[model samples]
Target: MRSAPDDDRPGRVIPFGKGRDRAYDAYGHAYDADEARGDHGAERRVDHLTRFMDFLRRRVAGDYEVDEFGFDPELTDKVTLELMRPLYRTWFRVETLGAGDVPAESGALIVANHSGTLPLDALMLQVAMHDEVGRPLRLLGADLVYQLPVLNHLARKTGHTLACREDADRLLRKGEAVGVFPEGFKGVGKPFSERYRLQRFGRGGFVASAIRAGVPIVPCAIVGAEEIYPKIGDLPVLARILGLPYLPITPLFPWFGPLGLIPLPSKWMIEFGEPIRTDDYDPGAADDPMLVFNLTDHVREIMQQMLNELRLRRGHAFPPLF
Candidate 1:
């Protein structure tokens, strides 16, 4: 038999050996050699906590600007968005295509498909544009978003406002990039079978807004959000009672209780297509129904095509496109 190996390694030594019992103290407590060692993980957490507290102090001191719509860039960047960063980067593993296509300076309209049951896609897009494109995207939200007291306050702080032509035009005129989901509740509340299908673009109002603002329209196709929730059914009666558009019933939701509320860890892709310049069209062209309709149809077609291409690239929703 070979001689017993030396226990002289760099780190603390464990007591147990080939045949020896654990080393114990007089009180019968086994000696733990590593107990006094520092934990790197704890050290890292303390560093992060220190940074976050500093950020909060700056915010509380009013060291940030707030826009007319109640957008607080400092608070959003330091707090609200920081909370979503892990989800966007780690959980969803969001990948962006054509992010460079987004105009670096001038205003533009970003129109994307909406799903994911909880509007988490919008939050992800906000993070993506801010992180990858180096620009803050002002989102156009539904009235329902503003009706909820706490959510409304948070939405405004995160740079989201009512999705109407007035707000859209205002933001664009101010040289702010605006994001809109024309599908609204229709796309978000649709069944899983209808996933990736482009719904009606809602009378081309967004196109008209873009035209009036003389900004380019950038069609965005977001994949993976549809599978996150996977709406299998709806409870219209309960929805009516609750004043919601539709009560979504996902496969895991309402069955697994609170645990089911967590979204599936699906890979996400957000691709921005080339901009469609509305500057080429006369401003008065916005008043033309046919013109708006044609532009809307064109945008819808472009987004749909991009979605299909991204889907092919993705290959699967669960494993994601790594």
Candidate 2:
């Protein structure tokens, strides 16, 4: 999410090469370079389509970059910390409650409540760590995100990979910080009726990942995102037809027509809670249903308490962004 240089402008579209379902452009090089420079811009759509198509064809034809999605430490640092500065300034007024608990070295599982209709909480947290605390946090993005054309490129460029034990263990074992929303898509899809009320977390995927890697679990709470795009209702049939996961009727969107997806600019607050040491648990503890349940319950409870406290401290349900 790094800032784009003045020279970086959105590119033109190109037709898909003969019979191909998608087109292509030279976008990945810029993407990688921008990430290295922490630059953000409207993705060169053609570039992504081209690269993806090439990747697909090559993979099917048995030739591709052997290390296609491998992590580039330096580039990731630039992208997450630098490019995303504008977003951090405009949307979130973030505060970390227990940044001190994050260790200087090694990987940790940052278990956080998923709010903000569009995953802005995670973006804000990444900027907070990179800009304020001087560390870069990699998010464990959902599989759905990777399905989008340009979004998938951005996610990979910004250091987000899939959320799974193998990826988590590999990254953690390599000494990189990983963020996970235990609530997954369910938390994000929770009705506006249940805003800020945490959904059920699966039994300890995050906790187990941490224990196996011997890292602490940092409980994080994000407030203000729930109200950003207050989803009041959904159109399931249309959503399915359009291939969109959910079609939200926000105050701005369906109510305001073209303006619906335009999030009413609201001041946001994000807080990072204390780290719970999972390293102390026996390696086999991940399988103990009772243990996972207790940990999941504890995280949910802490997030709820933090949400309430943040709501009270802020003293308003929503604040004007401008």
Candidate 3:
């Protein structure tokens, strides 16, 4: 802020603010007595812009790296993260815990309960793992995820593959941190009243994949996603016509048109539980239905328990973002 031009105090800050005491922080930048005090935040913002420009230069020069699955770590870490970080940090005010429980050097199957009208929980989880655990979490998405027009390409680039047993097994065996939401559409499409409820584990396919790959299954519980976009009703006929899972009718959507697409800024919590070792059993143990069923139930129980605990701590659905 430019104050009185006559005030001739070089680098001397006059404290005046409603929220915080006024102060000027310069990144070792010089200041003149008559000139306006420079803000470090502004300088840092310019630095961010410069880095982004360099990233664009790299992309334009075809100098970025991409894996066989079309996964671009450079784009995800540098570009896609810019889109997700704000929501994870500001809008939703997401709190991630137990990230240390995730095995750092080994492949692990991260199984989490899915909610939120859209698959925003998944995106937030991706950001949380990247920021907190310093790992690129690969998500096992459903067929519908890849069927969407623009999302299809973006998902692949973000390291999200189809939620097929084969893909899950392959990614895990390759020592990648893979995430799976076993409830699929049932978890996301369920009514708001049924929020946080686990639908079903579906023949324990995810467990089988984990067993085959001999990876630890880490149960993750996420709270606050239930309130992001409360699903009051569904348009089944329209969904079928569009070849979509379900046409969600939230409190704001359809009635409000594009404005309805805005997700409610509910607080979010993510907790990664201790790993349930599938390596304890032989790789062929996946073939045994009973073993897979038991492990699936165990994981589901742990996730539910964690969710219940997190909700207790969260209190209200829409806490103040600040």
Candidate 2: stretches off by over 4 Å: 1-69, 72-83, 255-258, 319-322
**How well is each residue in 1-322 modelled by candidate 1, as lDDT tens digits?**
1112222322211221111134332211243435314565575455446645544554566554577999876667656766898999999999988988999879999999998788889999998887778678899999999999899989998888998888999999998899999999988788999999988888789999999999999999999899889999889899999999998889898899998899999989999999999999899999999999999999999999999999889877877243
Stretches of candidate 1 above 4 Å error? 1-54, 320-322
* lDDT at position 178, candidate 2: 87
lDDT by residue (163-213, candidate 2, tens digit) is 878888888888877888888867776677887788888767887788778
lDDT of 3 by residue, 144-225 (tens): 8788899998999988899888788889988999999999889977899998888898779999998898889999998989
Candidate 1 vs candidate 3: the lDDT winner is 1
Global CA lDDT computed for model 3: 0.80
Ranked by TM-score from best down, the candidates are 3, 1, 2
Alpha-carbon local distance difference test for all models: 0.82, 0.66, 0.80
On TM-score, the leading prediction is 3
Which rank order by lDDT, best down to worst? 1, 3, 2
In model 3, how large is the Cα lDDT of residue 52? Answer: 52
Model 1, C-alpha of 279: deviation from truth (Å): 0.3
